[model samples]
Target: MSATTPLEPAASWYAASANAAPERPPLSGEVSCDVCVVGAGFTGISAALHLAEQGLKVMVLEAACVGYGASGRNGGQIVNSYSRDMDVIEARFGARTAQALGDMAFEGNRIIRDRIADYAIDCDLRDGNLFAACNARQLKGLKEHQALWERYGNTSLELLEGDAYQREVSAEGYTGALVDHSGGHLHPLNLVLGEAAAFESLGGVIFEHSPLVSLEHGSPVVLRTAAGAIRAERVVMAGNAYLHGVLPELEGKSMPCGTQIIATEPLADDVARGLLPNGMAVEDCNYLLDYYRLTRDNRLLFGGGVNYGGEDPADIEALIRPKLLKVFPQLASVRIDYAWSGTFLMTLNRLPQFGVLNDNVYYAQGYSGHGVTCSHLAGRLISEVMRGREGRFDAFANLPHLPFPGGRLLRVPLSAVGAWYYQTRDRLGL
Candidate 1:
């Protein structure tokens, strides 16, 4: 009901360590293009790059600086698969849908690698990710997950137990782990910024600090910002949780939630090597999971905890420091250099919500917490649809998504209650 203040990018470790990005002027006057994209994060930049490669004129509009949203602020793990796993998709959406999704499960990982190589975008690309299991039950689940993924041609997964787990991660806790050789980690902010640069190199135009104010849908969609307007043949909405009040139809389908992370001062090479022996990104198997990895400079970046109402905690370090200590008690004396929070959108089904609004308007949002790789996949799929290859896009768009219960008023509270239930199960080791 009331206008909220705009958010500036958090003073995160990623921001501090980011490569220098040239300042791009904001929109000022009228501009027309073949396609106008809202939100200059990964999805928008990726889509713009792909569309431009196809010789289409494209323009990207960002509410803040590029990668200022979750794209730049995320934990930086290149985790493959969706928020909902393949078995869950098979059970709920049927085997046909699961099969279709399975075919693309690893495409995101491949896209990230190909983009880095093709564009020579430097983002500290590495080669492995680990999933740690807290208890025996979680270890069993990991085994089942490995087998299920193998059925989908993910043969790069290797299950580890006992001494093997300890060898990979020198943590005190964790019964076992699953190493995904294909998945990895990177500097997310740099990755997005590099992609944005690549997009511009393709003759695509981008305007930063140009938030969308209003939209008039018709034969040629007209989108207006405070000081500028764009008339385009088509529009792409990739703003996700940060998109507020632009479209009424997207209101109740997803709610914004906050997640925090802390980065410790660069550890000694020996210390960093001791923490993760093989230098793989790790995430514990819990509903409220803890994911940590070593930055290129060896700073231990650890993240966990969530706020369902999208409110940042008074002290992000205080809230997340304990979680980090729990995993690596050896880091009890480590100085936390940076702490920040970012928001991601969650849908009722935990699956991404993708569909067409009008004949020429398309949207892809609600990646939940599994956005890093999926956002890239979304961009490619969206571009394909625009190019008349609709099958892959339909696999996701056809899935049904329910509105959050209680609409705007009670959705946060209801979701919090649900989260608590699952978190309790995670705690009880059920």
Candidate 2:
């Protein structure tokens, strides 16, 4: 459970469809850089790309291959906000802070679009994301959510109910949906690979299979890996859930959770179109929400269910296929093409945890399940902070984080108990 432990990427649909990327050599000997980043996932690569663009000498160290973690294996939905919604932020941090955070909520989506266009990333980018409601209560929640987002100047949201919902998606159970035109989906692994290429093109250096074993912080912090070491004027830790035991300070604030996904064999084009008429990524409004979308090759990718302690299920397909069938029984006879699970960090309040260990060491993690866009935004904010522009970064850094209630040994059980409450409510249609 340490970041330094060598791990291979899961045999996921994303891996099978990933773009061919050159193997980056592992780090050897000693190297010096203006900034050294740990964990070559979205946040690390993004920070490296932005910093390299600013002419800063940057080196990224990855415990495994690029995008080997959740960055590559996620649902690929460009969800445009924090795991904890803005209303929660407004209530907890006040309207002023909520306003600031709300403005930046969709910034990550914008960053992804800009990166795709500027670098010509071939990630099968699509437009539109839908939040489906499974019951009357959930539909009411979506309506309130829409109004909350509108108060923050997001007018791209549209409500779909009854026949309109059926028109958008052929799924039988959903009562309504909230469509966000600004959100979308794509090939996650390919997108990360393309971004890494863009980063390297900007003079950034990356070392794969090189995990940080120890750190010596000072004016020039030193990071030691198994075979090599790096001395950087500044350092950024972007490992999130997989950081493992590398940083003790972060371990207690966030707990790692696992989510599983399965892809069906390529369906007929007509069937795929029927499943999602508008071709939008969809997630339901449930505690352990179900999310699904169609791959470019016409396979259905459905994911849900979580393990609070980050344990992969024995049979991922068996664990999730029933959930898929509940939403679309027609897929019962279809063969599953692939199944995999990925871990994401969840904070006590379900918001991202951002702060500095010292003046020279900055870290961001705990995006829960919403890291796709938030991690990219974290990269931009990290780069800005490094450049002495702290306004935007401080908005998030200022948000307080509480450690899990029961420490490591009890945290998982305690979380499971709390989750049961919400899951029961979801099941009862409350």
Q: Which candidate is the best by lDDT?
A: 2
Could you tell me which 10 consecutive residues in candidate 2 have the lowest summed lDDT?
A: 1-10
Candidate 1 lDDT score at position 183 = 95
Model 1 over residues 1-430: C-alpha lDDT tens digits?
A: 0023264789999899899998988789998999999988888888888899899999998888889888999999999889999999999999999999999998988898899999999899888999999988899999999999999999999999966888789988788999999999999999999999999998999998888888889968998888889999999999888888888788788998999999999999999999998899999999888899999989999999779867899999999999998888888999999999998999999999999988899999998999999999999999999989999999999999789889989998898888799889888888
lDDT tens string, model 2, 360-403?
A: 99999999999999999999999999888999999999988888
Query: Model 2's lDDT to the true fold?
Result: 0.91
Distance (Å) between predicted and true CA of 122, model 1?
0.9
Total residue pair clashes for candidate 1: 0
TM-score of 1: 0.98
Residue pairs of candidate 1 with colliding backbone atoms: none
